[model samples]
Target: MSTVLIVFLLYLIGMVVAGIVTARLASKSLDDFILGGKKMLTPVIALSEKGTDMSAWLLIGLPGQAFKMGIGAIWAGIGVWVGSLFNWLVIATPLRRLTGKYNALTIPDYFESRFGDSSHLLRITASILIVFFFTLYVSAQVVGAGKILAATFDINQVVGMVIGLSIILFYTMMGGFIAETWTDFFQGLIMVTALILMCIVGVISIGGLGNVFSRISAVDPKAALLSAGESGTALYLGLILGGLAIGFGYAGQPHILMRYMALRSEKEVKKAMIIAMTWTTFAVAGAIFLGFLAIPFLRGEIADPEHITLAFAAKILPGWLVGLVLAAATAAMMSTVDSQLLVTTSAITEDIYRKLINPDATQKLLVRLARIFTVVVAIIAFFLGLRAERLVYWLVLYAWGGLAASFGPPLILSLLWKGTTKYGVFAGMVVGAITIVVWYNVPILKNFLYELIPGFFLSLIATWLVSLFTAAEQRRTK
Candidate 1:
């Protein structure tokens, strides 16, 4: 075998071994399998959140946008950084405390407990949403993994996808959250290292930042503008708002929030927040710069702009290093997919099966059900990935918008507003999800603004208004 193949295989082997070892620690309980027994330390939680948050979007989608659009792409990065900072500062501690107090294992469970939903309506609705949107979300990551493997190994895309999905399912199903968290910690480190190294190499090769901008200007002067080449003021402003709205989605993402919920203590949240924010800044900056730096080296050579980072790595790095970097890119896809898989499994086994179907089920039975659901969800996502036709960025954004709109407003309100009722939370979720579906499909609406922008506000309004009306009715009846 070639040195590259050997190196890549060894990395995969290590991940499999790690999964098996962590599986031993999972115990027979659903809590240990899904939440790592709530014992994750500061670094593990911080890095796992970062790893799961970035996904292949950091490696492929963001760089592709920067390469295609210019400095305007930086707005998305800024939005995410700011959004994450706020999420950590405002949401982390309260959420950690609330989940612990209520003995909630999932986001849906938190909503159910906080609002006193004895009917299990909120839990069912939330799990359905999780299953629906997360299927598409996980599929996007699968598609990304396919792209990475195809580019690196010259394999068929479908074949590459199967290989990637198989490995992800193996580790994730074998060890659940424990395996996913440890792998995410390692993958997070690799992701940042790969991005930083790629950026440094690209900058040096192009001579400097000045040369990079000049080359972009030479190609399309307007492309170098931060305003995204829009002529009308309204259009430019809209573009900026839409890009920044990407951050709003962060507040509601269940996979990222799962990291916060898994924290050992509320006090550790502050430390994790600092580490996460610092890591995000460097990682986002590096990914964006990689795109700008690729202008001179890969202007016309590659067909798909998303492949810029991988192609750039192969051009500059040695064989073993190239394999490692490529593996890191794959790591970006796997880390996110594994986490989402585990979350989806929890929704099915804990929320749907245990809570709704068999309230008396034993811990051993729940763990077994979780494992079965993991494989089932992975298979479903793999098929969806095969059917996916959009670019990684759009696919991810579409699913991101849906989940953010559906869950973000309700989650925020539940934690911050005492008036938030079960009725209001339910309304917010339904309206948010419906708006995304309608807005995204309509050409005019989608062209004007991202689905998340409208969906988020509408959902917030629905939640608040319905909550107030219901609270007043309850007072009158009493």
Candidate 2:
């Protein structure tokens, strides 16, 4: 077998081993399976959160956009960095405290408890949106895995996707959250190390920063400009706004925020934030530079820009080293898919099934059902990935916009602002999710700016406006 294939297979096996080892522990209960029993150490919390946050989109989609758009793509990187920082500074400690205080297991559960919503409307609504957008989000990761597998093995994309899905399903189902977190910790390291190495090697290969800039200008001068030097005011503003808007999702991403709740304690948030941001800085910077690096090498030769990182790596690295680096890239995808898989599983088994349907379900039964839904959800995403011809970057953004808009506003307001009502939370979730769908589908609207910006704002507005009336009603009634 080729060294790359061998290395890839070994990485896959290691992930499965991590899952198998953790499975016995995670299988103890629903909380253990989904939240690692809230016993996660600082490093696991930090790395796993970053790993889950970056995904294939970081290595493939972001770099590809950067490659195609040049320096203008830096907005996306900045957005992600700031967004993660926002999560750390603003979202992490409070979410961990609030979730722990209420003993809430999932995002939906938190909503129900926080608002004292006896109607179950808030939980059910939030759960539906989580499952829907998460399924879309998972498919994007599956597509990333398939793309990497196809690039590495020279096989059909569908065949590659199946292989990727099978491995993801096994490890995710077996080890549950603990397995995914431990594996994410390692995968996070691989992603950062490999990307930084690629950046260093790439700059050296191109004769340093000066030569890199000269070469970038030689290829696409506009790409090196912010807004790509668009003359039109609206177009220029849109690029800047849209790029910055990417960060808006950070506050709301269930997969990443879920990590905060899983941390050992609120005390760990600061240390974990430091470690996580360090990884984010190095990895995201490397990815951004790699995009520019590819501009000078594989510009016209590449068919799918999303495959730029893989193609560029194959160009510079030797055979065996290529195997190791590609494994890291694949790690990017797995880290994300596993998180989403578990989160989606949590929504179904804990939020929808156990809470609403079977209030008397046992921990063992819930754990078993979560595993089953893990496979079911992954299979559904696998099929979606097969038919997904869209770029991973945009597909991911669409889903990200939905989740951020739906949950980010409500969660933030509810945690920080005591006035946030359940009716307002429900309104925000609906408006935010629906706006993404409507805005994304309308070509003119999507082309104007990213849906996240408008959706996020509208959701916030909806939450605020609705909360006023509801909060007043509660006061009067009391």
Worst 10 residues of 2 by lDDT: 388-397
Stretches > 4 Å off in candidate 1: 387-397, 473-478
What does candidate 2's lDDT look like per residue over 1-478, in tens digits? 2888788788889988997888899989999999999997889889999999988878888889989888888888888899999999999999999999999999999999887777889888988888887887888777767767776787888888888888888988999998999999999988888888888889888998779989988988887888876778888887778778989999888998899999989999999989999888888888888898889898889988888887888898777767778888888888998999999999999999998899999999999999999999998887777666464346556888889999999999998999998889999999998999899989999887788999999999999999998998756544
What lDDT score belongs to each candidate, Candidate 1 first? 0.87, 0.87
**TM-scores for the candidates:** 0.96, 0.95
Point to the candidate with the largest lDDT.
2
- lDDT (Cα, 0-100) at 138 in candidate 2: 82
Residue-level lDDT of model 1, residues 1-478, one tens digit each, is 2777887888788789888888877856899999999987789889999999988889888898888777778888898898899899988999999999999999999998887788887899999999987887888778778877786788998888898888888888888899999999999998899889888877777777668778777876766788868788997888789778988998889999999999998999999998999999999999888887777677789888888887888888778878888888889998899999998999999888888899999998898889999999988888777765464345556788888999999999989999888889999999999999899889999997889999999999999999998997535533
lDDT of 1: 0.87
TM-score of candidate 2 against the unseen true structure: 0.95
